[model samples]
Target: MTADRSVLPRQCRGQAGMPHEAPHTAPPCCAGPDRENHSGKDSTGSDAGSDAEGQRNQAVFTPDGLTARAMGISCAAACNPACSDPELRRLLTASGISAWQTDRLREVLALAAEASPYYRQALQGVDPASISARGGLHRLPLLHADVLRRAPLSLLCTSQDDVARVVTLDTSGTSGRPKRLFFSEEDLNATVEFFSWGMLSVGHPGDTVLAVLPGERPASVGRLLGTALENAGMRSVAGNMGQGAPALARLAHTEKAAVIVGSASHVRHLALAWQQAGYDPGSIHTVLLCWDSVPPAVAGLIRRIFGCRVLVHWGMTETGLGGALGCGHQGLHLREADLLAEVIDPVTGTPLPDGQEGELVITTLRRRTMPLIRYRTGDLARLLAGACPCGSPLRRISPGRGRTGEGITLPDGGSLYPADLDNILLPLAGLHDFEACWQPWAGTPLQITLYPAPAAGTDRTLRQQAEKALADSPLPAALTRHGGTMFHVARTAPQAGFGKRRIRVIPQGTPPLNSGESYHEQLP
Candidate 1:
């Protein structure tokens, strides 16, 4: 949603132009000699009208204060002066991202043309300098995920020995091969530096952070985060999801951790375990939910259980493990310096305006190895339309809705996302986790299997609650307008692992019973 324009004065109905191939006569937003003109209002609490022409050729200032400027343009330097974090303040204070990104894009394209086989052919007739000069990077073709899955080596700019880390992402439920990401020492250090500064949004120096992310492997997210926390003058305790919630809670209590970082589900499980054992939260004042899209219900549950602030982190290994960090406001601040983020139509690959939901595409600016150019991240999100309430000038991406590629189609041809179910079911008091499947051949197309918490057991009340919530929800309710069994909720034995959750759609002609699920009778 855009900002409320009513707050601005009558004379503050400012206009701004978007970036195009042609150069602008007026100075770009925040780039001119008189930087003060970028401010919406002057010191006397009046509309600064003289700079209207310059502002007209620049980014839009919406009611909620979102600056819908061109991608890669840094506005963080115009952040509210009340900011406290020195590193964050310094990071935002630096501007001139458009020129910087142009230079970096040229460098990346040249390097890709010279070193990478995939880009050598993809960019065969393309001149790196001309490409950046003509229509910006948007004119370039999009790099799809299938390329990485099929041939990761072709995209690698560095030799085997120079690579410092390799992460293999599983695509078990999907048809494609698993994707492998290669990173160099320089790439890894850049991620560490980003984490050190970005983490300050939730933590400070001398604070202890309990990280519930995988750290056993070298250059794993948790290990790098631990390294970053230490670099930021904070203590770090790293653990993996494999270590049950109870053990992590004990570690948190023992170390008097001031911050906790984990996926939403892991943190929710930990909060439930901590509550069950009656453990005091102690020094824990903030929790950073990362590695996955956080459901509001899950965030609410964690906040209530621990009485701490909940922030979200959005990124993938494809983004060098650092994309955007939340400022506990409207949306996550884009990593504009190192990563150029753009929102594009998921189907057509057309760039969309800010606040329009689409596939998030990114291009790496600083990475020397395996740099991504116009890479399509299949997740559905958008650029936020207004300034962050916290007053940071960095462009922001709307939080993840769900993966467009993984959605399940109902019998009525409506789409159902795992996040749709997560938003409704995961918040139930007795539920620990759940899995969804599409079985159109069955009496009901939608099937949800609920796993109750260890202490909660397979209570009939929980089943009733799930049934009620599903029936009342708009998505499921709309599906049943045709008048058939809308959905079925069942109780199941708890699963061992908590890997990335997704909807399992039984392919056509496959017998539902042979899908490897041990189903019990539907809960009464």
Candidate 2:
């Protein structure tokens, strides 16, 4: 069920584009592909991932078993003519995505029309196959994320037994309803295959990779990450992300992990932990960030400490995982062979031109179990029609911004995303770390604190570091416009509910937004 807007805590209410401060407001309701649900099994009556008994019955997930399994899965997905081999490589690394996208659009519509109840009703009089990929897709309905969250089963194109996993995602809102998304084994294999391809950017087969994400279940996101790494000829180990940075540093150091994969905050925490322990972080070869945005601050920190390249992997729990990866080039190269990406005006639901910032909508060209056609991701990004310096032909995208629903609402109807705010702080060179929080304000000024990450020992340089960090930031001007809010440079990370990858902190007990999450509930 969608959150009841009428009873939303007063604090959570807001005007047209922003939700007022909702305490524990969910992660923008814009989670990365399976990012949150990567851990544990889906509550589908039977095992959602691999079942040992079924494991014996099915050779697909096993080592020597992949040949026939892979062949079967491939045959099941109606071959995507546009995204096929040599042609797909050209699309991902060169030009022709526009033509490729047109073909993909046709495929997505056909599948949805055949299987989805919602889409069938929406497209009753139309033939999905006849719809033009170039100028025709807009005539079809755009699927909102909230609709998938509400009546997801109505969107299914496959039978229940064919569903391999059901990911239930909880968002921040007055309502406690979590979005449930289904996937097939083939859908999951597509993700693993993408992971293998992407790892080629900065990894090798023999690398010992450390995965510092939450969850310990065998089917957790971390485990899946390890499996993907293993597929690429690397070894992976999942460790504690909640244990703060120190423990992580020691583990990485002890295990001699050549690569580390984590969300932005966890990576930052690892860097801090290394600094505190005087553990030389430069040993790690590379750092991979997923699920959350990496402010320049985070990228700078990881590079400085680990002496490694910082690569970003973009995907949503909805898209499965690892849909796009960063090249040494300016932006990211998409997994064009599998997922189709589009930029659009969030409000108008109209497609935007390349290089223009807009909401990201996705369609799976390879998925068969539960296809997402024109699914609005809620995260912000832009397509780069130009060539990547890395010489890859694949179309690229800007690292997406935080969820539009997660914006920091300004009093004058303006708003700032956590990413926008982070961009200001991330470039500050000297600070070991910083945490942002919104505190209670009885007056007109919005009270925000920048907690300094002081180091241990009596002779630490945290004060000097904090001062330099403040010097780099504009503070009041950076945070406030028209003198409506006040900013303070405090010296600590918010102790509560900061969660694994959260950069923005909303103080506890703050009432939720009055308008709440009703804005996007029209997905059906």
TM-scores, all models, native as reference: 0.78, 0.72
Query: Candidate 1, residues 1-524: lDDT per residue as tens digits?
Result: 11121221222111111112132232223321122233232111223235445533332221112211223223332231112223333333324455556787899999999999999988887777776421556668799988888999999888888788778887646666889888888788777766755664456555789988877677878778877766545688886656777787887888888789998888888888888878885456778888877888788788778866677778888998888876555577777667888888888888888888999998998787889999999888888876554455677787666877778665567777888788888887687777776776666666666777767744566678888887777775755654333333344554434367876765556554422243332210
Writing each residue's lDDT as its tens digit, candidate 2 over 1-524 gives 11122221122122111123222322222111121111111111112233323312211111111111222333211121111122222223133454555566677777788888888887777766666534666666777877866799988888988887778777654265678888777766666655643553445445778887754553446656666665445677777755656777888888888888887767776776676678765677677887777676567666677766677778778888656776544567776666677888888988899989989888777677778877888888888877653344566788555766676555566665666556555543334334444433433234334444454322124444444554466544544454434344534444422242232434455543322121112211
Off-target runs (Cα >4 Å) in candidate 1 are: 1-95, 130-135, 411-413, 482-498, 507-524
| Cα lDDT over the full model 1 | 0.66
Q: Which stretches of candidate 2 lie over 4 Å from their true place?
A: 1-101, 130-134, 424-444, 450-471, 478-524
Stretch of 10 with least lDDT, candidate 2: 58-67
lDDT of every model, 2 decimals: 0.66, 0.56
Best by TM-score: 1
RMSD of every candidate to native, in Å, equals 12.3, 15.8
Question: Model 2 scores what on Cα lDDT?
Answer: 0.56
